[model samples]
Target: MMEPIPGESKKRVRAKPATKREMSQFHTDEYVDFLHRITPENAHQFSKEQSKYNVGDDCPIFDGLFEYCSISAGGSMEGAARLSRDKCDIAVNWAGGLHHAKKAEASGFCYVNDIVLGILELLRYHQRVLYIDIDVHHGDGVEEAFYTTDRVMTASFHKYGEFFPGTGEVRDNGIGKGKGYAVNVPLRDGITDENYRSIFQPVMTRIIDFYQPGAIVLQCGADSLSGDRLGSFNLSMRGHAACVQFIKSFNLPLLLLGGGGYTVKSVSRTWAYETGLAAGVELRGGKLLLAVWPKLTIGHAQ
Candidate 1:
């Protein structure tokens, strides 16, 4: 089970659900309407239509589906708002990062494209934003959303070829004025920490040097960790946290979001570790110190 940040205050940052108008900023009206119309009772009736939006099996329709999407998008928008107002140097919405949702259709277990919504929010205050995806799968929806814009640069590192969505290519740079703004580093299975860092560090440094973005959005998907159900990489908890450490070094207004992690245990551990890192807390070996729950103890199994 995941625990709360150790030193975090009791004051909660409330986020309002994104209205249809707000969601329509980056999504199509028809698509937004379809999401609203979905309900558990009527889900079966609309199976044919749901399939049109890629909402089946992988993207199943359940109770409160619309509300879930709205809340997820709301968390991302809240993070963006906090960054824009300078309330915090780094805001994290671990609930967001549904990066594969398209403008008019859902795909790859994503529905609202909250990353796009968050980036749009950030663009209001910053002239340029940098989006970095470390998920096991390509961030196809986000890349497509800003493919023609130069204001936001998207970079993704994921498994390519014959994969689920199969979109991101090494040469699929941005189009028109947005050329060279999109960067893709497609990887194969069983990628270890050293190899991943060898490529990640240099590529990210180069993008930072060239883009000079005012703000940054990072998707820390834990599926790339070893022993994941749907991922193929061999990253460990420490290795995954190192990526967060490197990005935090930039010291820009940053929004951290969650993405495609399927293994429950690994995802919880990875996010908790990253959260501790973001909160500037050093987690040493032994029992954890949590304020929210006293019964929980964190340590290595003997």
Candidate 2:
């Protein structure tokens, strides 16, 4: 099979007509309205560049920034609401993992943090909420937002060592009661899907299950998707989706989040496929999505 060039124009690509469910409203109408007011221009008013907030290139403010971001934030929070209402065993939002948005600033590509909002909403009902981020990029904003809070356990498996945001060293752990709650596994390069599956699922299952978290929010960033333009990890969409399935199989009320995905083709389609898998929405007659990722190497043979 001939592989199409990576990042080449695939606008002709047709995603499997996936539709978004209605997100629950956790934030007050006032807060939601406040978010709607932020535009690319006014977004600068909430700047915090010196340490952990700013309007950088990747997160450049643009028109409709608030509109899309509000929906993203609301959807993930809605997933948490499902867990709270015990409506679904697992809720995944492919468009709602804006992890970098700070309380008052926008950073990384995240204009609003759906994970944080979801966790906050979940906390109202559940005693403990566990957040697991598997983006190749560090889930800095989410970690910081919940750093000192014991209600949420934010565990991140991301690339560190001069990586973007440069937070989440193996040591930062957590502060106060949140100690040991924030676990960071800053993995090195050359990591593959099997290695991730072996480590991520088992560890998460053990910790979350043992902790007996009332709910779980998983950030499945497709930047970790193989052939990624920015992400360093070489995980396949199947492999990443396996983590989602793992959470679902555990019978825990899971809320899936989309954290980071730069390579548009790989990120968009991977999220689409995984979202369909989690939602159990059978995609019929979908166009043949291209897989430009080189056939797996590095022990995928096993």
Misplaced by over 4 Å in model 2 are: 1-53, 280-302
The backbone clash count of each candidate, in order, is 0, 2
Q: Residue 126: error of model 2 in Å?
A: 0.4
What would the per-residue lDDT of candidate 2 be over residues 171-251, giving only the tens digit for each residue? 988899888888888887757889988888778867876678887888888888877888888788778878877776666
lDDT of 1 at 142: 96
TM-score of each: 0.91, 0.76
* For model 1, the run of ten residues with the poorest summed lDDT: 293-302
Writing each residue's lDDT as its tens digit, candidate 1 over 140-209 gives: 9999999999999999999977887798899999999889999999999999999999999999999999
Lowest summed lDDT window (length 10), candidate 2: 293-302
